[model samples]
Target: MEFRNTLEFAQEMDTKDPLVNYRDEFVFPKVKGKEVIYFTGNSLGLQPKRAKAFVDDIMTDWAELGVEGHFYADKPWWDYHERLIPPLAKVVGAKPGEVTVMNTLSVNLHLLMVSFYTPKSNRFKIICEEKAFPSDQYMLQSQVRFHGFNPEEAIVEVKKRDGEHFWRTKDFLSKINEVGDELALVLIGGVNYYNGQVMDMETITKSAKSVGANVGWDLAHAVGNVELKLHDWNADFAAWCSYKYMNSGPGNASGVFIHEKHLDKKDVPRFEGWWGTKKEERFLMKPHFEPMPNADAWQISNPPVLSMAPYLASLELFEEVGMPALLKKQKSLTSYLEFILNEIDKEVDSSFEIITPKERGCQLSVFLHGQGRALFNYLMEHGVIVDWREPNVIRLAPAPFYCSFEDMYRFGQILREGILHNE
Candidate 1:
């Protein structure tokens, strides 16, 4: 597929796009009375137009049914979160019984660690990627400290080699081997937030398991963006936020994946709550904590139906267009974006270094050599919504659901003009 930096070529690609119509499903923000080219789905997805209807239903049900809404609403609030499991399971590549919606990403991670991160006198070190998301880093540090160990000693970071933008699989595996008997758990971001590099989860999971270490993933940037096989990979647990690619509202509820092998185990340590008990026996209010037979066992409270409503709305779109179709378009769309970047770089004699490797999803984190924050401000003012990292990098994530080929082409034009004007 030859990509051209022309309006006609972009429009031709858009015409042939099977997912092009989905752009209308979302409500994009306007800049200067025109829809901006959105490239921040990795940060916060655009609000789905259907989200309003979903929320309205919940609001109406609450107004009419009051306390009875838990049992009497059209979609019973008591079981509302279950509606999200089927589609959410498919997104994360897990069985329906293996996934559940719960608290936010970091909160779920902390709760899951209670079950997976069991430290001993000799085996207490945890392996994670260097420069993980700040939330993850803080969580790991606090968890280690709570267990009476210094973070510098208990947490093993797999640092990228000098002069490299991304981590290598071999280095991670080697680090796991070096830790050997001391490795208690392996938890890293499935897709790095900074470089947009998709880690080799299957291989790394295998290696970590071989060393008698529990494994998990922080899929904040990976879920709904890349292909995942959490069940097949035998990951003990994983957690992700819904706001990014999942298109739930800001700081919305999160999703979790717990392997079937660990389900229904009475001995597994977890924070217990009434909602996590067996459904039939929950109302009985028995004193004993009999866990749910699936991933819902980890849930610590009743479902937040209001937060889950928008998520359910977004999953409807996922169900309409399966992940397979979304992934197929993602590859082509991202490649076209890369081609446009290279073409613009050559045309302007500018150094636009794409740090995101080939093993990536929709995001392309480019280092604008000799460019500054002024260029990012210029692009934003010109109706290009991209993310600016510290120093001189900008992350452009062209979400397949709403972003179009013409958005990429137009971004290239804006980028060229910004460069020229800055000079």
Candidate 2:
């Protein structure tokens, strides 16, 4: 449990690591000539070595079968998305029928909003965290305007009480209670992008549903980073992209979930598309829309086999290790990073601050005292792979699948040498 040095630390943890074989599974990033200690999987995950084979499988089908690839290939395009649903559903804690991989994140958010956000004249207001990811804010703003309402009056943003870095659960719960009658929907980010705080999803979902309001989650940062119970918690719906911790590659397909309870109801207002029709009768293509009876009903287009390929590969890793084990490793690795960062702070009395909450999903946001952009560039150039958010804050995520405790120790040394000593 304890090591006197970084090398000893890494070797010990790696020895006990159940998922260590996963390191060979990925192509870690190289800096100069060496494999840099990669700690930015929260921004973009390291690619799986199997990704090429997965993508090639689809390519091979296309080359050999041509137009018949839809139904004739090993993983036929006609049923490709189905191949991923069981594992995908298990990862997010939902029934297989309740989840479907679909378009990109922002696009799926737009589609879910169309059905979920029905602001009546009296109850037209929505509640959201202030400074949500810009993309989400833009989507909500556009949706409000398109529906002939002003976001100024329709959007209620909750901030940290006075000057706290993250919103406390009580603050959000109180606001929901006070405004519950007038709130039509609550759209929230599962993890705050700037601060790395994991929102209390179950409590938030219960409060929103208690007031008869639809709730949706943007799990862009939460999906693979933390354990979620979507069905047990009764979330109305949710959506997220797969490129980050899921390691599906950049701009890979995203997914959406609608509770099965909503699937059979014919009264819910939603945009209808050919892909949402029942698979057996899809070719018949009747004029009236009878949806496929679950989240699959949310799809508007056929599956893109190329994007789903890498995701299928990633999903296999999740199934093999299972989420509980992954989450356990994540907690230990992340705590190791935080411990070393604190040690550096104590040793140097430096002004660098880690404002990210301790309960965050496998990430810590470091705020530098000097010029942030310059300091961040120095770290990257020195072979410590991490990402910087604007104005300030560097995000370092020591992903459990491949990162070791030594990576954190090395990163801390990089910080102490690069930024702390210079001060």
lDDT of 2 by residue, 201-301 (tens): 89998998898888999999999899899999899899999999999999899978898888866688888788988888888968987888878888888
| Residue 161 local lDDT, model 2 | 68
Angstrom error at residue 135, model 1: 0.8
Question: lDDT tens string, model 1, 195-287?
Answer: 999999999999999999999999999999999999999999999999999999999999999999999889999999999999989889899
Q: For candidate 2, give the lDDT.
A: 0.86
State the lDDT at 213 in candidate 2: 88
